[model samples]
Target: MRNPEKKTEIRIVLTSDGSSSVFNPEFNQHYHSVFGALQESQRIFLELGLYAAFERFEQINVFEMGFGTGLNALLTLLEAEKNQRTVTYTAVETHPLSMEQARELNFDTLLNCHYLKPLHEAPWNRPVSITPVFDLVKYEGRLQDFQTTNRYNLVYFDAFAPEAQPELWTQEIFEQLAAMMQQGGLLTTYCSKSSVKWNLRAAGFLVEKHRGPAHKRDVLRAIRL
Candidate 1:
């Protein structure tokens, strides 16, 4: 059974089959590290999306919908260190990764050595200074009710697929995300569904299609203009 959170209504489970993935009942697919999951996250969201968005924010606020394996958070911290940029990262995961599950991820080969532990060991909801340039703040909450008094420079809407969780991908949700983003800020996601693009437009984002990484034809990158 999945634990419930007030802000988000995501249900997550451990595969327990030595597959190294957190299962999403909605998508019927593991969220992170199921099929080269962390690598794809690093390539799509961090290296391609967040780092590019960082060019505009000396101080970045990242609102991540699903913390999952904390891979994106880890990658962001590493990128911040290399770029001399500072990040205030906020991630939401109702069901977080256990120590055993975290260890099984084997991201040590993909990421350099220094980031392995801090990425896994960072305490939940407690703002920690993982590096001089990176500040981590996690919340065990839901995405629907994640209200911030402030706005973010980047938004990673990496929730389960819209089909699995329609609640997270609604016009209302996109409207909320758009409202919480800073002017001219960016939002990126692996999904490029027509309904998603339409909802983004309805929420006031200027959306564009971009070349996706290996085996993916396209991705959506939207700007809050």
Candidate 2:
């Protein structure tokens, strides 16, 4: 597994919507869109991915490609609590933030939600229940090396931009992910690149281009076939 601490430096940066995101110096990437981190995550991952999945399944198994800053997981946990929906969320990340780094983010302050600390502090490689309806399991390692027997109903493909991490956006990776999803399962990502769309198609997903949040023009949502 890649040691992000040795090769990368992270800094907190404010987005347009008053949320903070991590900026990775090695990849020249921010964890979320610069236009608005909260907005982007809410619209794409939560609204388009999780909520949509909940409409089709009573119990949801969500797999996240990147768990940077824990914004997406925290938001999902809040949503699950509000609706009393059962959610089993599993996320894989090569570089998890230190407790101090997680505390520096302003998501809890901005969202007025107090679960960020618990979400970040949850133990790795084990299931932990932050709330009655929400369970989380975080894996600290590379996506390519991660293994899971759980078939996910929803996926938040929140990796860095393709320009930064081309390997993660390829057909092989999508094929591997496709094998782990159930039929009609949903996968959403912030990127709308043609290569990404094509790769998803090649991996046996029915792809659609959706209106993105904030400054992004388009995002991709795919269903497993």
Candidate 3:
């Protein structure tokens, strides 16, 4: 069952970088940072998350905690194109935005990438080819129900804020994610709380606090060791 707290209305808000993010009334949280949605996604998830692992593997597998607006996935797709790499990305979201809600996010025109339309239109729970280089599979379910059958090389831990959804940032969740990654796999998030860093350490990850994107001070990048 979907968490009752995540069932609230989602409203679109423009971020600092002229990108739009969804604000959830229940948690009083924004899917991406209020600083700059595109800047945050590019810096945290792409630069630190995907690119950090891309050089080591010819073909990579990625798992995202919450696929919210599909911004991270879209950026990853663009990176794959630039590097001539292949990525199989699987994203799980307990609460997804409707087509109407998704269209409100102007990423397609902002990034000059027209593939965003087919990405949101693709059915859940099935892998679809977004491009010859990027394959995507989206699950309409909670992370607890997720079975780590396909190990991932990189993890986009883009869940709600730790204060709002503390359960998702626990040691158990980190352990589950660690078990799903290959050795030296990278996990990145825009969270830098001390407790979160400690939990990642307990989960056997070598955690590092990196300089964050605009407005934010620090973020996290952990490597499975």
Candidate 4:
């Protein structure tokens, strides 16, 4: 269970891209990049991660490590609606934002979409169709406690930085994710630290560094082998 005291401390902050992101003082981290929240999700998770998976798989099963603000899921839902593809998105979040806090985010206004409300309002621990093409199931717990029978084709590793949550970036966690993914599945994250790259490789993934969004220099994309 998340500390209620910590949950109350979450604040909404505007990113460089004019998107609103949650700032958790507990970890001293922003849910998205301070540079640009929307830009980061669109470029890294949607373009690099999901679109790449779409090429090989008829239907995409996506597992997200952090579902903060639901930005990635919203972007993915938009793509699924546009391309008419089927997507099953499962997100694990230990401390979720309240609906009031979720409503305060400007993602919908920035993206000119209305799915953000439904995405947040959707019930937890059950599949809910946000749209005909997109089905979402959110698990309200730590990633370690998350269990799923479905093997994901694409994973958005949007966890807080290593300094904030080192345990989640360990080889053990990467290995667990590797076990939950299909062969050749792709995992994309904003982190490209040497330790993170080493852990991914040690956990049986082929790691590659790519140009990051906005102010970031490089990000990582790993393939399960």
CA lDDT scores, all candidates in order: 0.75, 0.91, 0.90, 0.92
Quality of model 3 by C-alpha lDDT:
0.90
> Which parts of model 2 are misplaced by more than 4 Å?
1-8
lDDT per residue, candidate 1, 137-192, as tens digits?
77777877676786898988788887777888888998888888999888989899
Mind sharing the TM-score for model 4? 0.96
Clashes of each: 3, 0, 0, 0
Give the per-residue lDDT digits (tens) of candidate 2, residues 68-122. Answer: 9999999999889889999999999887898888899999998888999999889
Question: Candidate 1: which stretches are off by over 4 Å?
Answer: 1-21, 24-27, 33-35
Better of 1 and 3 by lDDT: 3
Given candidate 4, what's the lDDT at residue 21? 88
Q: What is the lDDT of candidate 4?
A: 0.92
In model 2, the clashing pairs are: none
Clashing pairs in 4: none
Q: Write the per-residue lDDT of candidate 4 for residues 112-168, one digit (tens) a residue.
A: 989999999888888999889999999889998777779999999999999999989
What tens-digit string does per-residue lDDT give for candidate 3 at 100-181?
7888899999988887778888888889998999999999888978985788989999999888999999999999999999
lDDT of 1: 0.75
Candidate 2, residue 47: lDDT: 80
TM-score of every model versus the real structure: 0.85, 0.96, 0.95, 0.96
Steric clash pairs (candidate 3): none
